[model samples]
Target: MNLFGKFATVGGATLLSRVFGFGREMMMASALGVGPVADAFNLAFRFPNLFRRLFAEGAFNAAFIPLFARSLESDGEGGAKRFASEIFSTLFVVLTTLTVLAMIFMPTLVRTIIAPGLAVCVDTVDTGRQAISCETRFDLTVTLSRIMFPYLACMSLMAMVSGILNAFRRFFAAAVAPTLLNIILIAVLLYAHWVGADTVTIGHLMSWGVLAAGVSQLALVVAAMRLAGFSVALGVPRWTQNLKRLLILAGPAALIGGITQINLFVGQAIASFKPGAVSILQYADRPYQLPLGMVGVAIGVVLLPELARALKAGHLREAQHTQNRSLEFALFLTLPAAVALFLIPEPIIRVIYERGAFDPTATPAVASVLGLYALGLPAFVLIKVFSPGFFAREDTKTPMRATLVSAVANTVLSFVLFQFYAEQGIALATTLAGWLNAGLLFLGLWRRGLWEIDRALVKRGALVLLASLAMGALLLVELHLLSDWLVPAAGLHRQLAALAFLVASAMAVYFACTVLFGAVDRSMLMKLAKGRRGRAKAAE
Candidate 1:
């Protein structure tokens, strides 16, 4: 399949996953809200999730996919399969050992790394009343982290399998697997509500649910691998030459990934000092993540292998074309999303999360943070687009160095901003850090002559931004006109109707402006569609 076809397959599945994830977060808000339990749970979950990104999704894939694709190209199917097996065995052993160690030292991890603020007791009153009134529970955080830490092991292995599948252009399974996680979590929340379980019990069950979902995700991807006519067997760890080279490359990539996650970790850790700050930020983050996952992640996952294959075959022009189009595609989707988030954050957050345990008072703070995060959305997506320029060429150290600078900037900025803006300041710090990272990546690529923005891409990006601004202007007016109907107390049906109308209007305006302004190339889209159809027919 062509690049656009692969993107469609992956993006569509990711869109589904994001929708389910939205539902999960909505339920979580009603169940836990921005309460002590919610804060603790978010803290606990962030620990393992951070490592999952570090090992499985970010660094491991960046390092492994290129090498795996090269093995497939140079040594044929058998060589690639053997290589995958060895990597899988090694990753399984390492992740299992790490998970065990993390579980054993969960307290220290929480005290030093996750939530140091929870160590001191405070006479804070429960404002939200979603859970028992208490200070942040350090012991509870540790317990939940230990329960959920195993998820990192399961998901790391699953990510390795996903990288193998992605290398083969089988994007559907890997993209769809995350939806299963949201589904399981939603189901657990529903069950917990049905049984009238307290927030703490619900939290514990949800942590276990994360582990269960990991197993299911791993099983699904393994089934997909099998269906693709590849059997990846588990074996004793081997220190083959290729494996050693992969480790060497992955070391820097892992640091890069860790640095990238540290941006969020810093924000979360600082937010933990205030009761419900973590959950509030989490709720606000969910909306922006939808666009990020749909556009940024889809491009990142599909672009890497495409660029790797092209570069390996000495097809520099094709690789550059792939990179430029990926950027165009990312901006086409992300610009409008960022505009919407920045323009209508309060309405969006209120409509989605300000019900049940999530009180009205929390909406403004979350909305403010969402707006700040909107400023960074483009940078985040750009990072995903540009980083592959380095990774596809097997130069992980450059991005790692860039990330170190960004990470340090984020830490310092968060600390400075927290004293004034509180959680919003932390959110702003993250945004500034994202731009710094993206800028550094762009400069590095330019210096190396690896990527260049052509005239067409620049024109299209400019038009996309203009169209997004136009859409945002329209949304602001429409929202103001529908202010009365948009309130949460106006009844769910009415509020939803107003929100739906505003969203549809914004989308319509954005698409019309882009098409009329020639931002989107009609013929190119038609050609891609036609190519996809022809390929489907040939396969049939």
Candidate 2:
């Protein structure tokens, strides 16, 4: 398989999902605003995603794929199919039991996850000088969380199907599943407005939308898996060797690779102390995810199975090359995206989010968090790309250590920053932890002699950095020139037009310089354009 080709198809689909996500969030911002409804929805939405990332996306995939690859390589097609069927049967029952427990005890879970925020509304705060009531904020969060917590059950089923589909090296269905969530939310929000619903009603409708999204996503991937020459038979099951291997891998991978989600959980816990903190963080985090999910994660997902296949065949060199290429691509694209986020967050936020209930006050606040997140974007993407090396080797223990350290770093930083910066402080903590996570991963890889940087790669990376810096400078200048145009007292049409101009200009500068300087060579471009599955080679 040509690694790059697969990423393109999968990444392109993921990009469409992100675009739909932007639309969904846009509607969310307008309908719910950055107040109680927004905070409640964000708090409710994040935990399931937290577990999804922890259990299903990273750790589970890390363990499952190599085993599935082995089944395919050693035991043939029949063996691989049997392995997948057992995994499906086992995961379905386990996740169903867990979800039922979670749903039944969701209120306690909500309070535990956002204890500080809930405490504010549920308790009275005392100071020597003053006392304040926090009942409104606390009650709002608890109420919102209750409405949306069932999303976990839906996503778990989807995540299992996602894993099975991905194990078959069919990424399109799984990669595209998330877009449905975005689409469903958008549809719900629009429907609420069409019928002239109030904010509370809209929030309630959107909560149901979340559950519906999970079902839609699960169905989409299950169908895609069937089309890709796989069918998961649901039934009573026993734990096979493949299942055991998955548990062993997923357990450590979950602890290690779940740092990012855990960091968000901690941040939300802190944000719960202040009104609207969670909501602002969610808005800022959305734009950041666009690049991370579409490109960074797409590359990682596509490369995992490829790396496993190569390793099973004792093709270490191919595996190494694959890792190198994956890092380069992730860094090259993510660096520019980081630059864009850091350089122009305010305008981007204003254009997309500053309307209806989302006021101008929210723009700089959300933008500030987005800027901090940009500092770690490259590291965040690199984590996805590099961890597969350890995962494909069935080494999940190393990343787990790094995950804990990063999580601790994030927690400490959140408290330290929140002393004054408030919600942005929590975001900064996460940003710093991401950098820490990336640094530790690179160090571990080097210690094991698993990663090395070629001088050519170093030279090219430097050039990309310089080119992106130049692009950032250009964007800053343009933004200043059009500051009047961008941050204006106007309708949505005018604001959106300026945003379009800004994005186009940034794209022009970044791509133009990369191509002009031959920093992105044609072959590399062709490979990226083709994705990880190299039908390009076959075509040639």
Candidate 3:
């Protein structure tokens, strides 16, 4: 399989996971609503997820994959296996210790980092109607965070295994592993909803489900490793030179990840000050995350190892071509999704989440945030494309510096804007931060002579943007034409049908415009498709 083929494999799997994630979110909105329980649960979930992103997905993958791939090239399978086992043992020890410490200090974490707003609410004398006491919410968040903190350990180890798999060019199992998370949560939500459980019971059940999903996801990926004839046995931890070197590289990358998470944490903390804002932002995030995950994540996961191997083999031109193609492909899909989200977030939000206990009032807020988030979608994906330029070369500090600047800007912007625009301000701050991060990463790559946009990429990119705008224009008219069926009074099925039609029409118009405007290279796409088919036939 080719690079884009590998991207499709990962992206297709990611799309499935994102769809299931949407289902899980919809069920969650119905089960908990944008209430105290919802706020608490979302905040708690974000806690472990924040660290998982910081340590495992962010720093670990960035640092591990290049070294692992180099080991494979220089030392063969035997040496690579030893390296993997050494890293695995060391990671296991550190993560286990961190998880225990986090659980032990869960209350402090909740009060300080997770949701200080909840702590403030707990202290304030309520002067308004309160469904649940602030103290109760704070306690619930702490408990839930403790229940799910172990998920970090599970996911961190899973990420190590995933890095190994990606180094081996086996993308499917790792890409598909996330689906187990959504699948497990959906099942738990379904059961809870069927039994008509209260929000508190549902919250507890869901937290447990998250931990279970973490374990299940790890198991699936490890099983994939074994089947691929790649197994790392965890022995006593060692401080080998390679382990020391891995930590040295991962340290800066970890800071970069931490900086990124701090941006998010700041936004979440400020949003927590407003009732239901955290849940509302989360609802809006799901829409944009679909494209980001499918394109950005797939590109990041596939591009890094590919670039690492190419650069290691002194194939500089191949590395540059890979980067260009990855960027072009990312924008081609991401631009249209961003345009749609910006143009018609209300209807999309309504169709997906404006059911059950999800209030109609929250739809406008979610839509507003989603639209702002849409503005940064391309930049977010670009970061994925450009960061690998540095990471694949074992240059982690450059992105770290870039992220630090963005993080500081985001923190300041969120603080200044939140007082006026509320959650929308936070969203705008995040978007601006994303663009800043992307810009810095790109500039770093260009100035360092590591990357450049060839004319073909630039021409095709402008055409893709043009095509996306055309689709957005057509979508506006389509939405107006279908407004009758798309309205809330039209009922769920009618609204759903109308939304689906609009999406399908938008897709048709966009691809048609891309072809008509010569935005995509038809011959290359054809070749890729033919290659895929040939490979399938051979396997059969």
Better model by TM-score: candidate 2 vs candidate 3: 3
Question: What lDDT would candidate 2 get against the real structure?
Answer: 0.77
**lDDT tens digits, residue span 399-453, model 3:** 9899989988998999899999999999999999989999998999999899977
lDDT values for all models: 0.87, 0.77, 0.86
Residue runs of model 1 more than 4 Å from their true location after superposition: 55-58, 124-136, 257-260, 528-540
**For each candidate, what TM-score against the reference?**
0.95, 0.91, 0.96
Better of 1 and 3 by lDDT: 1
Best by lDDT: 1
> Which 10 consecutive residues of model 3 have the lowest summed lDDT?
122-131
- For model 3, the superposed segments whose C-alpha errors exceed 4 Å read 55-59, 122-130, 255-262, 532-540
Model 3, CA-based lDDT: 0.86
- Candidate 2 at 147: error in angstroms? 4.5
lDDT of 1: 0.87
